[model samples]
Structures are given as C-alpha cells and as structure tokens.
Target: MGNDGQSVGDRRGGLAYYELEFADDGAVARDTGLRAAVTAGQVDDVFVFCHGWNNGADSARRLYTTMVDLLADGLARHTPDKGARTAVTGVFWPSLLFPEDDPTTGRPASAPRPTGGELAAGLEPAFPGNKDNLARIGVLLDDKGGSDRLAEFHERAKKLLTTPNLDAGEDSGERAAAELPTETVITYYSGWSRVDGQAAPGLADPVEGLWEGAREVLRTLSYYEMKNRAGQVGRGGLGPFLSTLATPDGCRPREHLLGHSFGARLVAYALSGLADGLVDGASPVKSLFLIQGAFSHFSFNDVLPFDPGRGGALSCYRNRVDGPLLSTFSAHDRAAGWWYPLASMLKRQDASSQADLLYRWGAMGADGYQVDTASRVRLAEEGFPYGFTTGGFYRLDANSVISTLQSPFSGAHSDICHPEVAWAAMAAADLAGEHQRPAR
Candidate 1:
C-alpha cells in the first residue's frame, strides 16, 4: 500500500474478497470462500467493491480495507442504534497497470503521475515493464507509415468488437485479446496519428517534460482494458458469487456496490449482467455508490442512445434499487472530466463536436444525466458529501469539496476517501435499507 488515502482506525471487520482466477478463455476458474460462506449462511450485509484502473491486488485490498473501515465508522455515526454490520468483498480482476518501458537508459522510466502531496497517493509503483511495451508500440506506429495506421486500428478494433455481436458469430476469449493491446492502441491514437482535438494543456513533451503522455497512454490502456474486462466478468464470473449472495434465505444481508473510476464502470456492467435477478426483485444489491466515476453520466439514462441497444449497463439497475442509485461527482476531478470522454471519443471517432462529443465524453462528476426529473433533488446545503436521497437517481455534487474546498490544483482524481464522503455513503445505504424493511 504505497499511498493510502488517509490513515484510519484498524476496524476492518469481516473484510473478504473472492480472489479469482480467470481461465485463458476468461471463465471464472476458482472462487475461494465466497460461495462456501454464502452456502453456509455466514454472510450478512455484503458490500461488493470493485477498484478502478492502475491498481494491483495489494493496492485494491488496502483501499477496500480502508474504505470499509471508514464506512463502518460512518454507519455508527448515522445509525448507532441499528448496529448492522456489512461484509466487504473486493473483486480483483486482471486489470492492466500501464507500465511504460523507456528506451534511453534501457530501463523503465517512471511514468509521470499527479503528485499533489498525500491526496493523490495510489498503489502504482515505479515499474520498468510498461515502458518497454510502450516503446515497442511507438516503434510499430512509426513503422506503420502514416495516419492510415489509425484507420487500421479502427477497423481492427471495430471488427473484434462487432464480429460477435453485429455479425452473429461465436465471440471467444481469444477474440477479445486478438485486438491490439490497449497500450498499443493508445500510442497510435494519441501519439502521432490523431487529426482532431489536441491533448489537454500540459508539459509540451510527455517524455522530455512530465509523464503526462505516459499517464495519458496508461489511462487510455487501463480504461479500455477495465471496461472490456468488467463486461466479461460480470457476464460469466460473478454467477457463483452473486447467486449465493442473492439467495432467498431471508437472513441474507442487503448488498451495496461501490466502484471508483473504471471500477464504477465495472459495477455498472456487473449490474447489467445481473439485471435478470434484479428485475425480479431477487438481487442482492440494495444501492450503488459511484464516487468520482470515470464513466459516462448517460450510462443509466433511459433517454440516451445506448451502445448495446438494450440500454446502458445501469439501465436495468434503475428499476431494482431500493433507495437511489447514488453517485458522488466532483467537478474538480480533472482526470474524469478530461480523460474519460476524451479517450472514449478518440476510440470511436465516428462523431464530430456537434454530433455528440459531450455525450461521448460523459463524466458523472462533470455533467449529471438529463433523463429523469426524479433525479432533480434539491442540492445539499452542506459541503463535501452532500446528500440527496431522491429514492431514484441521486447525484451528490461534491464540486466544493474537490475544487475550492479540499483538493489542490492538479485535481483530485483518486483522492476520494474523506470522512464526510464516507458518512454520505453510509447515509445513503441506511436510507436504502429503510426502504427494504417493513413500513415503520
């Protein structure tokens, strides 16, 4: 745990995760204690957590432990009499950590990352592997001749994605990986081939000046990998785990999902996969808490044109929630605002500015969805984790906390572990729980 958000009390209780092994074919091979615990009925309230991009297993553990501990503290503060405990489960998948192998000194140069003191601390270490891969990518693109390389990539990715869905063929695990590694795609897209919008303001040369280029490259790669993997695991892997968690055993604890960054997208996809049970009121998830999510705000909006046509990942989730699909959005999350839609837009460069660029680069923190008037709850008068339990879609505007209040200029992309934010999360969960119990 290199950079934990804040030092909290060691009250991480019943914190466990389904450490998984996905077959080369992307099937869930092993689910350790999760199924056994649920089978034996030892589980209670479950808080299934998914981490965002650039995090290894250890980092994910440390973060989940810290968040669960703070959430417990917040629960006590909000509902001291209830005394209900939650089981925290961290789901770890083979999410890529963009390691840039540098060529000059024949060692991996540490990529540039945001360093605004303790707030921006994460689990990424100085790795030498990604630099080499990144360099290879650079050389390949240079060898590809011209901007036609981008077109090649576009066709390659499009074919890989659309073959199974659009053309009605068998899409296998190999097909997903058949496309270029997201790392290569990033080098080609943002490196020298793009003919559209420029990179955000930064040091001119990512290599010579700062690691912004490296960061962007990693961001691009991590985003694509996580989004793709989220869909994969959600569809196949969580069956054993979710089936038991959502049992009809009566004593099964209510479940809550909290995903940060790309993990936010993971939870959404998982919900989409689990929507069958959710639609029947048999789902274990009670509420979803998205914090500084690095996904589209239109992900759950019914009015928006969905990529898959069956509605966005969270589309089916809206009908299942007990209280609200809670999201804590911060305009000061510069990465979410700039990187998210921008990276996605570059990948699907089929649209122009007037077409749907804003929709394409949607960040829940920057722009809230425009689908439901029920989402229009009154703004919280307090600061940080402002509350708006509208019983449907509740987006907490934490702009004051992230921008002028707490975070520094570089922005607070991953610095979302404040006490008040935890309190808000538990408060929302508590409200959701109330909706489940008999009328008081």
Candidate 2:
C-alpha cells in the first residue's frame, strides 16, 4: 500500500527549507539536497522530526515549519552557544497510504473518508488549517448518526487488529516486531500522569461517551498503520538518511529527536533500530522528546519476565541515549485517553489495565511510562522540567506547562506551536546547556 512513484511531494513553505519522503517500499523518494549536504559535510547538526496521523507531505511541511520555529526559538534561549548549523529533516512514510496506488497512473484509488469531515471538528481544533473538519462536530456531539459511523470504523479496526499482516510490512525492524504482544492487549501508560487518578489500565473505558469510541477507532487504526510505517521508515529510509547526514568529517554534530503523536513512536522505534546496530554504523540519539505520543506506554517494559530477557524497543534505546527521554502528555488529548486504548485493545483482550508489571499496554502520552523498575523523574514536581539531570526517563503534564502558552480555551492537543511547549522540548532535548534563545 506504499507509494513507489518517482516524484516526491512539494517541500516548499517549511522552515527547514526542504523535505524528504519515504515510499511504502521503504525507499527515500529523493534527497539531492540532503545528499549534497551530507557529502559536503554542510549539515553540522541534525534535528529530525516525524508527524502524526492525517498528515500528508504538504501538511507535514506546515507542521514542521511551525514546530521548528518554536524549537529554534527555544534552542536560542537554552543554548546560546549552538556552535554550529543544524539540519532538520521531516520524515514521511506510507503509513497513511492505506490505499494502493496505481503504478502506471500514479494515482491512488481512494483516500480515507469519514462521515464527519474526518474528525477534525469533534476533537482538538485550535491548530491551524483543520477548521473545515469541524463543521458537523455539533451533530456528532449531539448523539445522532455520528456514533454509528464511528462504531463501524472501530469494528473494522478491531478486525484489522487481528489480522496477522497488519504490522507485517517489509523492512519492519526487529525492534518493531519485538514490541508486539503475543496477544492483543489494551492498557493505560499509568503513572502519576493519569488525569482520572487511576493507576490501573483496563478499568477505564475508552468509549465512555459519544464520539469517544468512534474517534478512538480511527485514531487507533491510523496509529497502528503509522507505527508500522515508522519502523519501516526508520529501518529503510530515516535511519540511513540520518547515517548519511551524520557522517563525520571535522566534528560530529549532536543529534536530537522530537516527535508529536505517532511521530513519537517513529522516533523511539528508529532509535531502537539504530542502537541494535540495525543501521550500519549509526550513532545514538542524544535526547528524545515525545510530545503526546500514540505508542504503547509499556513500550520500554519487559513483557516476558519469565524469560528474563524479553523486552521491547524502549529497553534497547534506553541505555544508548546520551540524554534522558523526555515524555510529555496532556490529559485533554481525547485521542490518547480514548483512541489509544481502543487501538491497543485489539492487541489486548478485554481492554484491561490489570497486569503483573510484566507487559504494560496503552499509549505513553496518555498513561505515562509504564516501566515500574526504570529510574524516573516526574516533571510536575519542583525544579523538575529544568532539573533534567542527564539520563533515564522523565514524564511531564502537558496541561501544566503547555497550557500557559496557548489561549486559555484551546484544546491542549492542537497547540504544539506554543513557545512554552518549545521551551519544554528544549529542556527535554537536553539543549538547555548554556543556550540563551528566547521563547518569543
């Protein structure tokens, strides 16, 4: 279902100036500029990005341009002595390419079509350019036809969840394969980060209200597909791309990864592959910043405890990272609270959070990190966000700090452009070492 066309999408408008995409076949479409940069050693620093669902190349451009603005602004404040230039790459994959495109005509047969403007309206809307999707949100909120459509989609996703081939895409890394549960399971990332004050996972119902269940269906399906694509992109394209750009000449620029939503999953899985030497001579990531991730919360936990060696990508990358993994979640993100559970439920039966501390299910951004034994710091505590003391893991409440930067009424999910979020990201990326860039 991936695109293998010779041409790539438009890359104009993004602040990074240019962008690159990966085909579903795991090949980077084109990277003349990026290749030149790497060959000439012009790209001294690397800052890579991955986008969430419902995003195309054009959309990714806008998303990264804005996100980079905040990140760059925050970097200026945090690291006054940046010392060198940076290359920001926006990674796109065939995760969203659910439909197979005709190789001859260069057109897909169809695109994702939801009854209610594809769900932009009912959930978070403050983010720019998604206003049209909200027109029928009122109808969905009022409890009418919307629920039925959403449920249908959820059923379809549930079926897809059971399909053995769902995550079986070629170029799927060992890290990706290792992350899957033997059977389906759903869990909350459960920690102090839970908004409902619940520690258990399965107790909470994902479809508690109207639109929640349906929205989750779409979200979960998209996430599963994208998560797989993330692995493929990492193994086939992004990883090699980084290796190329990261080629050492005079000095190696520090590397940082930042992802929003499923992009977070991509970044984590990519690092896992690189750490295991999956990519030929790839360097480790400095710091990881996961903003509202849609992947499993227990991704870092060892599920097969009896084996004593069974674990997922989190375990592989945890030790290799030079800086602490900074994970931030917002309670208001209906997608994580609802959709992530529904999606994970297909992998887990009964959608229960009850566990033996062996394998934790659910999204990291929603439930927080589930690895009980891992060293952790709660950013909500005093001197926390700024007190990132080098390594291990840290979880932050999105509403606590990210809210202050946006309009009071904006849904916390769509405000990634805020300077405060950027500030936190800077802290998470471990770029706060003598950086003095302003958040303005």
Candidate 3:
C-alpha cells in the first residue's frame, strides 16, 4: 500500500503511462515523476484516471492500462497525428474490498459471518482509534447478543462514522437514521434484504441472527467512511497536485479527468480544490468523465428536487469544468442500483412508492445526473455521432454496452474496460481540445 506511487515499468501498449499515488489523507507521495514527464512537453494531452473501491495497486494498474490501451488504439486509427502526444496517469489510493455474494443465491458462497476477531481485524485499518469499540463489537458478535447489544453496536459504529461539528442537513436519510431506534434500523435492513432476495425463506427470525445484522451495520458505516475519505483525498491531494501542474502564465497540457465508482466522487471533489482563479483560465483539466459513479445522482444539482432549499455538495462547482462533464449510468450496475441506495437511505418516511425512495437516494451510476442542466445520450461505438459540445453536462445511457452480469454484488459495475467506453472519453477530450483556449 505504501508503494502506491511506484511505476510498474511495463506499458502494455505503446502508450506512455505513469502512476500517481495519494495517501488516505489526500497527501501526494513525493517524486512520482508524473509531473516531470508531463511538463517535459512531450505530452500534449493527459488522461488522469482514478479507480473505485476494492482495487489494490495491481488491479488499478490493470484497469488504467486496459482503458489507456483502448484509447491509444482509437487515437492511432482515427487521429494518428496525436497518438504520440498523449499520456496516462493512474491514481492509486487505499480502498477496502467488501465480501462478494453469489449471484444465483444472493448469499456468500462460504461462511455467512466471519469470526468476531476476523471482522475486527478486517475493519481496523478503515476505522483507526476505534479499537475499543471494535473489540466490543467483536465480543457482541461472538456472543450473538440481543437488542441491547445491537443498540450499543449502532452507537459505537455511528461514533466511528460520523464527523463532529459538520453540517448534517444535506442527507435527510442519514440524519433520520441517526435519530432512529435500533429496532427500526434492523427492520429496514430486513426489508432491504428481502427486496434484494437475500432473505431466504424459513431462516431463523431476523432478530435471532443479530450478529449477521451487526456485520451489515459495520459495512454500512464503512461505506460512509470511504465516501468521506474519497472526497478528502480528492480535495486535499489530487486537486492541489493538479493545480501545481500549470504555471499561472505558462501553457499546459490539455488534461482530462476520469474516475470510476467512488473514484468518481474523488475526482469531482477535486474540482472544489482548484485555485479559485484557475477554474476559468489556467485550469489544467479540460473535461471530466464519471464511469459507473457510486455517489448521488443529484451531486451537481443546484436545487435538489426533494428539498427546495438545499443543493448538492458540488452544485456550485459545475462551472469549474471548463469543458464537458459526462457520466455513464446503467440499469445493470446493481452496486449503484441496489446496495448504494439501500445502504445510503437508513430510513424513509414518505407514503409514496418504493421507486420514489430509490430515486431520492439513487446513485449516479444507476440513475445518471438528475440536474436539469444535464442532457441524456446513448453510449455508442467508436465512430458514432455524439455531437457533444463544451460546457455541457451529459448523462450517457450505457445500459446496452455495460449490461454484462459480472457479479451478483457488483453487477456490471466493473465492466467498463471496453473499447466503446474509452472512445467516449477520447471523444470528450477531442471536443475540449477543439475549443481549447489559445496558449498564453
């Protein structure tokens, strides 16, 4: 994990590739050599990519290499002149992997619950300083304690996940969950599992396997923690590093940002960290592409439909994108379609249909961008007529291409290494370069 910034020295294709690493605290590692390579003027275009959860350096490298190889091939075939002028930098960070469930049965293939000690050890890195609470949770899980123990676990989990002195009004579900009784939370989980078809018939009562529920509670907390960390690393680490890439008066390479799943959130938050004066003028990044994003679809909405007075966290930063901001969504992405909303919404009070609740808490990968300023487009082959322009927000319907049922837990969420997806990214970069500002 500490060697995140080191290069593997193997470029699968003929493309110039590099690896830039960031600590969980958003701190850039020293001497990655990416900036040096880009500033050498050999590269005119830079595609910076970030991977989502569960990816170690090895997996992240494969994703970057696969996508970049496609991009390089596309450029060689379509725009041969620019083929040698492009480079790629894969961003590496520490993200934890969740257990996978069988697609057919909707349960883990092996044991349903890890030993209490195993659970604690697996979670300790993500929630440091919570050793005492985690130990208590382990003991309770081993004992299969009752409602009182469940309530205690919630308190401890909340303490580990919640940030103090922060604004809590943004996510109504999270706020409501904070005030919910332990029993209600369990009921919500039970109902969610039933809808997901994970609750098998004739199993012990929902309350009997309280330890299973406890494990779920911990997973939910971990989700929120990773969400927060993605933003932290983006703003504190990647964003600042990007700013340093261009001098106020010097010409810089045309940069494009691409992120998948939680990595999408990380790159979007990077917009907020750019120097105020650079967004419109000296900003190095030109376009942004989110492939199967895991964050809220309403993240860039100026005014949320549910709450008239509130807006998304990145609402004001929309103009920060000097060119197009594109996001891909697919119905096959169950991580965003199902678990994302289920874990996100701890409680719901409306009397409306289940679709309404899902819509309110839906993810960008599942439902696309919900902002009124965004337009929808179909994900097409390499030479399809996209007609995309600068300064536009596009929700690309990738259902046709990203529809493979890769896994039960993360249905097609990671099925984005296709050539068509790479073409979409390259298309946006082409548009941005066409409208690029003249060098000062």
Candidate 4:
C-alpha cells in the first residue's frame, strides 16, 4: 500500500505479518500477525485473541505483535518447557466504532458501520427462537438506523452475484445479455422496532427474559454465564470471531485478549457464554488474563448462570482458579473504582451529564450503580464465593519486566494495550520458556 504514514511488512509467504496505517494525523496505526502452522496431527495448544473496546485492526495487530513478542520472551524466562511450541492466532473483529476526532480522516472510522450491520442482521433469522437468538436479534435491531452512504455498494454487489453459465455448449452474447443479474439487498435493521411509534419497547421485559434464559445455560461462577447476558451473546464481537480464528492457519496458542469498561463486560460474557462445551461440559478455555474487570458489579448468578443447588451438571466444575484462567488484576483506578459507578444519579435531561449515564449501570447508588444494601446483602448471600481463583502471581516483581501502571485517567479500560499491560499478559503466558516441537 501507499507509504504515506503507513507501514507494512509480511513474512516471505505471509506467515507472519505486520502493518501500520494512520487513520488520521497523529493517530498511529499498528497491525501484526502470527499464522498458525498446526497440522491436524501436529496440533498442540491453540490461543485465539480477542481485543477490547476502541481498538481497530491496526491497534489489535500491534497488541498481538507485542503479545507474541512478550510471549516468546516470557516463555524463555518462566516455566519449564513442555516440549511444545505454542501457536498464536489473532482474531480481528470489526472495531470501526472507535471514536475519531480528526478533521482529516473525516469518516474513516465510520467504515465498519455497514459491515457491523450485516453481522447483526445475520442473526436476525434466528430471532425470538432461542433466548440467545432473540438477544442477538435485539442487538441487531438496536443498531439498525445507522447512516451508511456508501454509493458503490449496489453496483459492486450486483457484479459479484453474477455468474456465467459455463456448461453451455456454445457462448452466446445475446444469452449473456438477456441473463438477469442477481442482486442481494443488504439493509440495516436494528433489533428494536417502534413501540407504537416509540423506538425502544419491551426493554425491561426483554432484558428480564434474557436473564432468565441465560440462567438455563449457565452455572454460578462458571464461564458460560459470564459470556452470556440478558439471553444474548453479550461479548459482541468474539462469539462470531472464534469460528473464524480456529481454522488450520487461523490462530496460535497463548494469544492476548484486552477489553475496557463495557468491553470488559463483553470479555466476561465471552468467558461465561460457553453453552455446549463450557457450561454444559468442561470449558475449552485454557487461560485468561483479566485486568480491572467490571466483575464486582456482576453477581454470582451472572457468572455461573446456574443454580448451584443442582449438583454437577457441567463436567468442568473445578472451582480452584489454577489452570483455565489467571487471577484478575486491577488497581484502585478512579474510573473503575469511582467515577463509573457515580453517574446513575444524573437526570436524563441533563445534557452536561449525558456522557456519565452509563457509569451508573453497575455503580453504587440510587438510579445508580449500587444495588440496595438489602439486595446487596441478599446477593452476597447468594454469591458464589467458590467461583473466584485465588492463585496467581499477585504482584509484578522487579524480576518481571511487564508493566501495567496507569496514568491519572488510566484504568482497566485503557490498559488493554498499554505497554506494561501487554507485558503483563506476556508474563502471564510464561512465554519466556523453551520451545520444543511436539513428539510425532
């Protein structure tokens, strides 16, 4: 591509790749890749990465590169070799919604609006059928009205849909000219429809239904319930992403996942949404590294998705947090610790405080983050204390090189790709160890 503030590099045959493209002035772009070399017989462990909020492909790539570099480096330093080289895969979900303030890039970040819509619509056919299905439909309907003025879409789609009749014994120009062009109309449809002219209807009921549906598929503290929310696959991008990331050369082992604020909610959902393997059986998760997660707001019922009074439903019921996930790392950062939960008190009509509304979601007080003290106590009584993992390298020692120290406004959300945070993940992966080929 053009080198006007853009950089690109790839391995000889595209095995490893990296690219950096600027979306606007002063906004840096970074992209990197590590292709999987795992053959069916040679496959060892797989790591599929999912990134957090406000990140684009370039940023995700850079994060992944940093993760791979950190992994390779960490492995050499920490644990003993299991005589296997871990493969890494980077899962790039559409992140076009990342904010863009530059006058230069105009609507560059707005590019993914259409694709995001299409992805949402793909789930519409499954709506109201299953709780998860309905939630997806609702999410799709929620974003239906976004403006995308891409003019060339119709012509381009028409061209792609046309195919020649190759079996014809002789080529006929008139026949080709008379052929009707196949056209597929991709319309944007948000999950919400007017409630007698109102845009959002059944909001409370749908949300309640989602929660109830979710309880059927999850266990308290298990990964399944965490990933599903209000009966929908709440983690947004990654649920669809894993299917693409697990192909033969799709991903590697020990890839990194980073999320911020609501993004962290999605990550938690991804972790707990496993229905077939994770909730119903043993989870397929090998390791997870979470930072400044929004978990405190989530209840035990939210995480586990199941009533513990019912015994041993899912086989992967090990409660000790040793292997599958790393202990969550967090700081007393202000946004996560303070500001986020304080916004619930703001009146909806207060334009000045509009931005703060979401902060009240899981926060502390009335019309705010806090659940009532009585309810809090009740939730505690119903809490899954056995859910959390206590084992982990609690502190990043001097001997360790990964750093996640936050700046004044920095908290779990912005720490996703912070050099130190990335390094922390590297350290978590034990990437500094020896690598050996798997035995034949």
Candidate 5:
C-alpha cells in the first residue's frame, strides 16, 4: 500500500540491481562484491524470485521487466505515489542446456539437447486422477524402457511397502505391483552438485545445484538482514526475504512470491525444510503463488507434514492447455509440449503427453481437444484455491480469474501473459465456493 514508486529505490537501502549466473559451486553476479555495495534506503518489503530451467540471466531480466511493468500498472490504481518499495532481489540459478547444431552454419553447438520437452515430460505424472485414471503413477513406474532409474526406484519402493502381513495371502505379482511406493517416499536430491558424470550409478540430480545454492543464499541473506532485528531472521527463501521488509526507506511492508515449473518444486523443498526445522524459521512466508507446478509424487489425499504457520498462505494457477506441467504442448514448443518431462520421470507415469491424459478425461469440455484437461483439473482442485474435496474435484471458469486479478501477479502460463486470459484465470482461482466437478 505504500506509494513513492519512483523514489522508493532512491532512498536508503535502495533496490539492489543484480544479474548473476548461478552454478553448482556458487554464483557469478554482475555487481561483484555485494558485501561492499551499499544502498541509501532502509529495506522495507522484499520479493524473492526463482526462475525455471534452461533460462539465462538475460531471460530472467526480461521476466523482471514484465513483472515490473505489471506491478507499475497495478500500483498506479491503488497507492498514492504509484506503489513502490525499497528493494527488489532476484536469484538466478544456472540451467545448463544441450548445445544445438545450427542449420544455417552447420554448427554443432547450435544443436542442443531436447531440454524443454524433456522437462515437461518429467513433470506430467505428478497430476494424478487425470483422465479418471485413478492413480496415473503406473505410467512412470511402468519402466517400459527397461533401464531407466525411475523404473527401478518404483520397483524397489513397491517391494518395500507391499510385502503383505506375516499371515497374509500368497505373493501375487499383481499385489507387489499394486503396492507402488507412492507414499512413504520423499524425493531426495542430495549431492546433485557433483559434476554431471560424477554422481555415479542410480540417481541423476534434477535442477542439480540450484536448490542447495538457494538454501545457502537464503540463509546468508537473512542473517545479514536481521543481524539486529529480533524475530526477523529466516532460512527459507521467502522467509529470509521477508526479514528485509522494513528499516530501508524505500522498502515497502508487503511482499509477493511467484514461482513456475521446477521452481515450484524448489519452493516446496524450502517450505518443507522450514516445517522440519532444517531451515531457520525466524519469519514465515505470507503467501505462495505457484505457476505450472512440476511436482510428481505429492498427493492431496495424503497428509503433508508441512506447517501453514501463523500467517502462511497458498495459491496455484495452472494452464488447462499446458502440455505437461512445464511448458506448451504443440509442435511450436517441441521441448516442453508435454507436462514437465522430468515430472513424468519422477512420478513414474507413462503418457505420450499431458494433453493426451487430459483429453481422455472429461474435464476439458470443448477445450479438451488439445488440452490436458484432467491434469489441469487435478492441479486446480488440489492446489488452486485449496486442496481437493472428497465428493469431487474443484472447478474454476473464466469468472474466477477476474475476481482475483486485483492482487495477484496477474497472468497464467497457458496464456503466456495474455492480459485477458491471465486476468480470468486469477479471478477463477480467487472465487470463493466449494465447486463440484462439472459433468463431462
């Protein structure tokens, strides 16, 4: 609600402009020696941003520009001086992509590995109950390829959990398979920072060093901010950034967090860490805005050990047309045309694409043609306004988005920032009511 947009960063503890390319070992920022850099304003509000995979510093800058533009517009209507704050910080993690072979010059580096599509495929199976499929985890656990580590993991988990009681019936192969380790398994990415080929046998780290680095940075940043302020230090990203919300002249009093795709997964890890006391908890997050989430194994029916905190909040916005949880599906977006590829790998499901799964389910309605109707419905139901209900899933239409536009980041992944569509989706997610699944 604070004004002074233009003058916000000009004051003490002013906005810190940084462009850093993060790597497993550490990060390289445009402004070297942040320890020495000083701003004029007392930092008030903080917004910590996490970028998705395959993105460079420049791409993050562009995203920052879009967010700034939208924020400016929103501020013009509400705050007296156009709504500005003291500090805005961004964390840029490295996203290594396969080099591409250029057609024009026949350059080998121009030919990059199929990163986008791969990422989308990895994220698809996280959305269960799509296509009325009950538990789509079978796809990922299928291990049809015979040699994928994912398949092996599921197989092992199934064996450990479904061995039958001491006096139980014969060991039916069906029963062994049915006992998939969907529960009691937590995704572990430790030691992912080792060089790509160095990790060895089974596990290949996804988002490798990103999460670890984020944790270290958040801890360091928060400690630096609250050296003197009591009950202000934090460990998780959002919590640490919140510690910087006051004292700086241009700093505002409120903050917003926005995450997409694998970024959402990292956020979840941060939150989980906080709940488990692995991360410091001097301050807690106000809200979480998730976009195109790419988690594969989490289920709403199950109880998550996470704590909502005294003032924590959650909101999700998924694109019905998004191929996988990661990116678009069409030929134009060959790389991410399916639900986040990695999600599929992690969830251990098999679907040609997330869109195929949705089309098979009755959720899409007219939009079902090229849409992953079921996946979106699951995302909207379990994650959007809130978790899924017992009787049926929750459904949101265009109207729901309109109602929430006033406060959110104001955009949708499927629409790719199309103002009208983004606005509608936000409104739908913001609408209040227990929505039953619509008839197919």
Candidate 6:
C-alpha cells in the first residue's frame, strides 16, 4: 500500500501483491522484497504482470490490481484452493505517454500545438538524460523554424531516443528510418498524420504539414525509445531476477508472466536474456501470456514468412517458457494497428502492397504471432475450455472482448482488464501448474 518503489507488502483482492520497480537501464530497485518473499515460499505461484508504455507508476498499479482482482474472482468461482497461495508481482518501469487522438471520433485532436515549455515538460521524464535535447526541440517547435532548424530538431530528437547497440533487435525498418533523408522522414510523418486513426487520404503537400509532422516524428522516436527500454529492463533486470528465483535454494515457484503492450516485449526479451546464458539452470517461467504485445509478430518465428533469409530477434528464446506461450491480438487496437506500423517503417514502398508492408512491420498485438507453428484460438469466456495442455505457441484472437473503442489512438489497446482476459491468464497458469507437477 506504499508508493511504487517502496511497496512490497501490498495485498489486494484476497491475494498478496508486490511491486517490483526497475530503472530504464534494467536495474531493479533495492529492498523491493519480491525476491525475499518468493524465496520464503510465501506463495506457490507468482503471476508477474508488466505494463507497457504510456503508463505511470500509479496507473500500472491500478492495472495490476484490476487484472489480479479479476483473476482472483475467476479462481474463487472455478478453483478456490489455488487462489490461496497465489501472488501478483506488478512491474513498474519508466515509460511515457504519447499525444492521443480524440476518444470519441478517433481523429487527431484540434488542440493547438504544445508550446516549447509544454513540450519540454511533457518529454523530460521519458528522456531523462536528454533534457537539453528535448528543450532544444521544444524551442525549435515554438519557433516554427525553417528546414535547417527542422533538420536540427529531428537530429536532436533522434539522438534523444536512439536505441542502444546492445538492445537493437533485427528491425530493418527502424534502421531504415534512422538513415532516411530529412525530407523523406518529414514526408512519412505527414503521411502518418493523415492515416493515423482514420481512413483519410494522404497529405497533399508534406511540407505544408511540417510543424505537425515534426511532432509526429518526435512521437515515433519516443516509441522507439520505449521499445528499447522494454528490452533493456527485461534483459538486465527481470531476467536476472528470475534466474535467482530458479536457483537451488531459491523459491522456484511456478512463474506465469503476463505483459501488455511493450511489456510483452519485456517478458519476451527476459527469455532472450535467460537463453543467452544469464542462468545455467532450467527456466523458471511456466507460462507467458502477452496481451496486445507491442513488439514484432514474427518474434518467435525461426524465419520471416516474407523473407526466408531473416528470422525474428527472439526466435531462439521461444521455448524458454516451460508451458504455453500465448499472445492476444485485436483488430481494434489502433495503436498497434496503425501507429505501430507507421513508427516501425520509414519506406512507404517497401513491399508489393500496403498490406504486405504492414505485415512486414506489424506488432504482435495487431497481427498475432506470424509463424507457422502458432495455433490460433479465440478468447473464450470464463467457463470455456482452453485445452492448453502442452507447451507451445498460441495466438488468441481477442477481438470478441477486446473490441471496445477506449481511445481513438489506442482503440481497445488498454481495454484488457476484462474478465475474459483474466480467465485466459488463469487458465494458462493452471496448465503451467499441471506441467510442473510430478507425473506418475
């Protein structure tokens, strides 16, 4: 019941809850007590939940609490005994919120552009080390500068959110974006504004929309930063912590990881870190349920469906989960459906068609796991059977329940606090428990 990094004994909805705070660089906060509590065998099962970008510490807590409460309710109705020893670990990390479209119409808001101070204030926290760069960009925005100044602003913004060499995945689109000419980048940004959340025609003149285009470019850069940070935190902090839990004298509870948006990328990268020899023993992760994952759909694929010569970044880490690896996708999630693809690509003509290009750079949340090995299933109600008996990849079409239009920019992206989703997580955990039990 304490503040983010200070809380370790919080309890909610008849279940023990712990906050595990991590820095952007993937360092765990001191004295969080998650490790000690788990090692003490306080719980037999741990549901580790991580939030994606656009969430503060408080919002993340609310999300975890709400989802965990739903899970608790499901358990009470279905399997009462299992709820007694279960615990929830909510992961809090640094992420920033992007400007959103009108919730009612799903179109760009008509609000005036943010002033220099406003821009700086809004972005300073997310780019902590680049305060000066953010301030400069803000000044440039306010000045309505010429092409030279616009180029400078873009350079500063890009540097502010540049991906670290260690955390850079196999994202050719991202690389292409970084290498694009300033004018082409502006053109892409202008095109994004017209196509963001509406079926609008492309912009008539990219230069005319330079100011808005610059802001859009900034948002894209922030997205890239958040993506990189997710991987960094997962690999450096969460993965090492999980390794500790897997130690001989450690707790070794059946761990079920549930992450939403970029948080899904976090958990997936945690497995990557573990697979890269961070831990010598077998993985402690029993089940992984990625809700509206914000990473590449081909993350678990051995080779890209369109390009056989290349494979996903996390392909080798797919089997790290001892039980099932499930991901949810919804067509209504505009953040994943629209913005994700736009931010991912620089070239508008990369593929044979627009659909092909989107598929090439699509997010897991919008497109699901794009691999031949993944089995597709519907997101069922509480009492329905999931039949997740064995360990493998499964993509759940959550459009039935995750179809609510919460916001224009991120339609139903954050509408995952539903009972059906909770049931799915619990079902996955139950299957993982079955796998962990000694066989006759």
Most accurate candidate by TM-score: 6
Q: What C-alpha lDDT do the candidate models reach, one value each?
A: 0.50, 0.49, 0.73, 0.31, 0.28, 0.75
lDDT of 5 by residue, 242-349 (tens): 333343343333333444433443443334323322211122332333344322222111221222221111111121101112111122221122222311222233
What TM-score would you give candidate 4 relative to the actual structure?
A: 0.40
Off by over 4 Å in 5: 1-43, 80-82, 97-253, 273-284, 297-415, 420-440
Model 6, C-alpha of 299: deviation from truth (Å) = 0.9
Write candidate 6's Cα lDDT for 1-440 as tens digits.
55533424566667778878888888877435566666666667888999987636777878888988888788778777777678888888887776443243334456543466576667788777788778888888787767998789778877865556333244535544556888788766766544344432335544447766777777777777788889888888888777777334644778889999989989888887664443222567878999999888887788877667867787767667777789999999988888788776677544777788788789889968877878899998887777674456789999898998777668889889999898888888873123333211
Model 4, poorest ten-residue lDDT window? 374-383
Each candidate's TM vs. the true structure? 0.66, 0.62, 0.87, 0.40, 0.39, 0.89
**Cα deviation of 249, candidate 4, in Å:** 17
lDDT value for candidate 4? 0.31
Judge candidate 2 at residue 270 and give its lDDT: 65
RMSD of each: 8.7, 11.2, 3.9, 18.0, 16.8, 3.6
Candidate 5: RMSD to truth: 16.8
Question: Model 3, poorest ten-residue lDDT window?
Answer: 163-172
Candidate 3 contains a number of clashing pairs equal to 0
Residues 283-380 of candidate 1: C-alpha lDDT, one tens digit per residue = 66667777777666766765445343444445545655554577776767765665455555544432466347656557775655444643533234
Can you list the residue pairs that collide in candidate 6? none
Error of 3 at 281 (Å): 4.6
Residues 258-343 of candidate 3 have per-residue lDDT tens digits of: 99998998898898888777765457777899999988888888887777888888887777677778999999998899888777
Model 6 poorest 10 in a row by lDDT: 431-440
Off by over 4 Å in 4: 1-43, 79-84, 95-263, 279-281, 294-296, 299-324, 327-332, 345-413, 416-440
Q: Model 2: runs farther than 4 Å from truth?
A: 1-18, 95-223, 247-251, 275-282, 303-309, 346-360, 373-385, 402-411, 434-440
For model 1 the local lDDT of residue 368 reads: 56
Q: For residue 96, what is the lDDT in candidate 1?
A: 46
